[model samples]
Target: MRTFFITALASILTFPVIAGTMDIRVLSDINLSSLIVSPISGQYAIMADGQPVSDSAKANIFQLILEGDSIVMKTLEKKIGKFAKVIFTGVGKNNIIKIKSVVPAGRIRSYDDHLEVSVYAAYMKVINKVDLERYIAGVVEGEAGGVTTNEYYKLQSILCRTYALSNVRRHELEGHQLCDLVHCQYYRGRTTDADIISSTAATKGMVIVDGSLNLITAAFHSNCGGQTVNCEDVWAIPLSYLRSIKDTFCIRQPHAKWKRNISTEDWMSYLALKHKYPVEDSLSFNNAVSFGQAGRAVYFKDKDIKIPLKTIRGDFQLKSTYFSIEQRTDSVLFRGRGYGHGVGLCQEGAMNMTKLGYSFKDILVYYYKGVHLVDLASLEFFREE
Candidate 1:
């Protein structure tokens, strides 16, 4: 956990770096009892409780299942001995493996480097120990997938890397650095996208930092609906780098606008029961149905009654808090703008900027205010100085 300081004139900065790895909990949300692991490339040393048993080439494919508090291993035609832990140590370069869950019948996925399998609580827990760059590529592919330019991919790569390193110890108590979920970053193992891999390499060890040399939140979303909101408006914390700004790049992109309908009864009942709004009053009822958000508003209409737009968005399952309400026959029509929390970088806007010939640095600075791109190694130099 290091921070880098930079001069005000510089927008992009760099320093040396040491290659590292991250342990990510794979299929973290699934309650898996059994899974099949097969080697796809390179070699893997199969170890049962730290003792080498066989190589991946000899085993070809192996099945792991949970039995009581231990893990049972099996091959195609024979059953291997049960062990408390099973580890697949990736040897040499180009190590890759395919994993498919058998208990709940989940889809197959390919991963790079090593894997650690053990029994946790009532189910089997699998962790993918992958290189840092490889993990960032997988995260970028999962978070932003579409026809994208190299600059856009590079922008996303730096953001993903910064986000990853910032929260590296999020699940340290659980025996992993991060999880393959949106809670950390959406990572689905090794990515096959050539552009994504190249972009990640191009921006290796790059991260965004505030003026105080601390890593920014690096938050991003699908679209901003023409403008982004300040961090305090969303999370109630004033982040200097996460200021609101007008972004016209994603004005016409997909997910920028959405419409949802909620019955008047349901809406009134929720407001009346949960928020204790004066639903019976004629003025409040009219204001509730006719609420409009020409721009982002922290709370619903009326100064005294502070109904957070975020709460309304969550209760109604709306796409975003930037929405306008209208009364129809028996329902309230919510015309929503944007597709996420509307903070920090806008993925579609950055992609559009790349199409307009803007470099990755240009897009990064445009979204994140008063931030500098620095390398991890610079922290030590700045501290020593």
Candidate 2:
């Protein structure tokens, strides 16, 4: 299946920005034959874009409706005698809805079930329905709290990319049919709306190439026990973009955030009483450290390639084993553990940036070095024809 470049939804803050096109790898995790939307009632409804549609329509896949818009479906069901929109996408023996999107007749929307699907369909490969319900409830029951920032965006991107890449149809796209999963590396959807397109656009041309600058067959990973893995060692594949380094260790801080009506002391007190920590300074640090850097470690197995660790000032050097955070000067430096997707760019690093003065753009650059910012307009300039 062919994937289109991202739209203005995922990148540009403003909706009216010109568009760009790219290919995304789709995996079996989310395929045209993958979605399992069930109709709430006997009468299932379809949505062309956001408007309502009847049951009878030419619902073939890959029916491109427009450049940026999409044809989505929402089941119209009676709630307490009043109709409510539900996930009832009309399940039958074949368990498929009479989809009426104009994107294509046979193309699917690539949605399934997962936790972070709150922003996108990354949650397609769900383990169980019970887990899926708990996740949705956790996010919706106000347990995880309403998304006030782009954290939802971040989570969704990771999920989508992960799913697409996991079911990679082939290693080099040599014989296997081209895919549309993030695992395949690129991200393009048949018919994505503003938000999805915008997020993808933001990361456009941001292919995770190997050190040789060749498409490295990149795959994003979550917190790596504090030590960032060498691209080649971690995945056993060379990255075309991220270079093999003299040292794999980089100083990253715990992202601090604006007071969520919280305080260091009061928060500690809550932790002590509600969670289970003592209310002493030494105990506090020990408790946090003991629990924080406890059981995580990332190692570069190649003996020849030794990645050194040091403080920003080049004063203190760290050992090869699990490195702990050392309190340095102004920054209270982190000796730290795990690599990308760890705390602060270091997993929680983005949150720390949000706490600090850095915007989302700043966060992306900090982790992805030497990336350039290009307008989606430039990407779509000649393609508009």
Candidate 3:
């Protein structure tokens, strides 16, 4: 969304540090109607509408339901009255809770710090107020599953923290900082993996920043085929740190290559219907069917016609914009390279780099050009100076 890099960078420096606890809406994509809450670790205090309820003491299990504009809070023994909002505050450190959705039938999830339950329209709103590092660990676990090198997790943590800090104001009007979805970051719940936890803790206050000391967008994807693209190519904004670079580490990884086949007739119909391509012209028809890509091109060749590869990717549900078309007998074979947008850091590339004994700093610098890894506190201190 940045227009001019230097001018927009100045505004990002003024964002407040939302440290300590982060308010993230859990099950944000689900239309939850009811849920079961149970504390897993440490002490917890339940309060309704900012007041201590009678059933707050020794309460092991609590049930919450959405009733009109109010939240119906109750325990196994008795009801705790209806209120506009129900709050669950942890007394001390490592206060975890298990939340299992009952209405829509969701999985049981564990969260840290505190929680807030309220009614929003037809669904029950559930927010998890978790500590910063714990949230980052959860995000890493959700985005990058499977046991891998701690170095990769550490790299992921910095990127997640950078993204979170930069976009903290994204959902300010919606009451919470971010959602538990890909819209922000995939944050399922608190991670139990020791390596992930330690990796997150290792990069506690670190983040990637541009030359102006502003936090970068920290964009990442599954794989980049063989080369990462420039920011301007994907989002139409030129960021100095997001320049294109050739990467050999991810070429042999999974999701690096994919293929699909569509009928030549269907492909021609699509071009004619969508772009009003001149199907009658012999040259245009020949070029469309037989196309090759040595490197990534923004447009597919059709003589005088220029079709955006991104548009083709969306229309055909292709993996990436980098693809080549081959004319078969009746079907047009689409050989695609890479998955996702092919911009920023490649996850598989970075993972392989870590396996080769590259540090997180080295991998980050290799992918993101002309960027500096700085502590959040140092940035604030320099801003004041």
Candidate 4:
């Protein structure tokens, strides 16, 4: 990943303006045998093996197949010869590209930008080269899921932008800046929701930065129960801005609490096998099996065994680490609060805040402590292509 620094500018007028572009790998997590590429609007030009094949056509669609160690582009209606590399460029700014998976049914996605499809590891990798703001709109729709208010969308947009900018080189070795997956960021494509698009445009080029003017992680989750967790507690990396805070706004929202039941025998056996827990000892077993958490606990404690709560959550496929274990007659009940890693911004809480007439900046400051909102265009050290 490339790192940049920004010195305080004397005036916003003197800052150099730069247009941000991102090369995001679409459907990166799925391995497809073939894909259908078409131009939805405006004019498109196709290039294969560094040479132009067609340009500015009324209707253009091509099928891409993986052949040996290279990608072959063929027309959908007629069988065309194979090609090494295929580049679909928009002739005008109004051009839109649509790519659909032919192998999987009901798998169709469109992009409001150009595309570069290439072969990698015997799979087709489609890279969507799009404007930063437009990409943020898609990400907001994908991650936030139709927030009711523009304020919430604005908050999501800023976080999405910050995360995208910070992790720009996440897939650089794979020939793209980022991947359209949860690992990088869940980005579907251009968002049709007018509110989300307007919200994203409203907060254009704005991103969250730490007190030192460096980009923050911009971590977020679906909900946080009634309180958020510290970054150090979850990831073991202590970030000054990511602190635990009480968040009651998300309590009434969905995904606030969850429960799971497991056989008592299985639960004990798992602890015994994984941590050598003394499940046979009645006293230690009793103490370890039943516990309550008013706040997040680092570990499920016993006299000698200190099992990290995260490990237990993962072992049981629980919702979160903030859970309490209850021993029933035949089963052990695990009651969990929140969803996801539970560090940084709580999406539900932020949404509620927006509903209560809070601005995006207010919601950001409430979740991430001591952060600055900086304009990407004004960053002297920032580079974009």
Candidate 4 to native Cα RMSD, angstroms = 4.1
Model 1 agreement with the true structure over 133-208: per-residue lDDT tens digits: 8999998899886688888889999999999877877897887788999999998789999988998899988888
Q: Where does candidate 4 stray beyond 4 Å?
A: 1-18, 55-59, 76-80, 104-106, 381-385
- Cα lDDT computed for each candidate against the true fold: 0.86, 0.31, 0.87, 0.81
Per-residue lDDT of model 4, residues 240-342, tens digit only: 9999999999988888999998998898899889999998999877876687898878888888678888888887788888888898989888888899888
Model 2 residue runs over 4 Å out of place are 1-148, 151-219, 224-227, 243-336, 339-346, 375-377, 382-385
Error of 4 at 314 (Å): 0.8
Model 2 — which ten-residue stretch has the worst lDDT?
Answer: 111-120
For residue 23, model 3's alpha carbon misses the true position, in angstroms, by 1.1
Kindly list the per-residue Cα lDDT of model 2 for residues 1-385, writing each as its tens digit.
Answer: 0122333223323222212211222333432212333322233334433344444233322221121122122223311111112222323332222222221223333322210101123222111111211122222212112232344344334333322322334433432322333334332222224443344445443322212222222233333343444454444454433433221222353221111122345434544564454546584544333322344334311223222222211222322223443332222233444334222223343444555556655554455455433333443452343
Better by TM-score, candidate 4 or 3: 3
In terms of TM-score, the best-performing candidate is 3
List runs of model 1 lying over 4 Å from the truth.
1-19, 55-57, 380-385
Question: How displaced is residue 53 in candidate 4, in Å?
Answer: 0.9
Clashing pairs in 1: none
Query: What is the per-residue lDDT of model 3 for residues 1-385, given as tens digits with 9 covering 90 to 100?
Result: 1234444445546667765778899999888988999988888888888898776676889998888888788899888889998888999678999999998999999998899998876788899998888999999999886767999999999999999888887888988899999999999899899999999999998999877677898999999899888878888988998878888999899989999999989999999999999988998888888888787788886667788788899998999998888999999999888899988999999999999999999999999988889787765554454
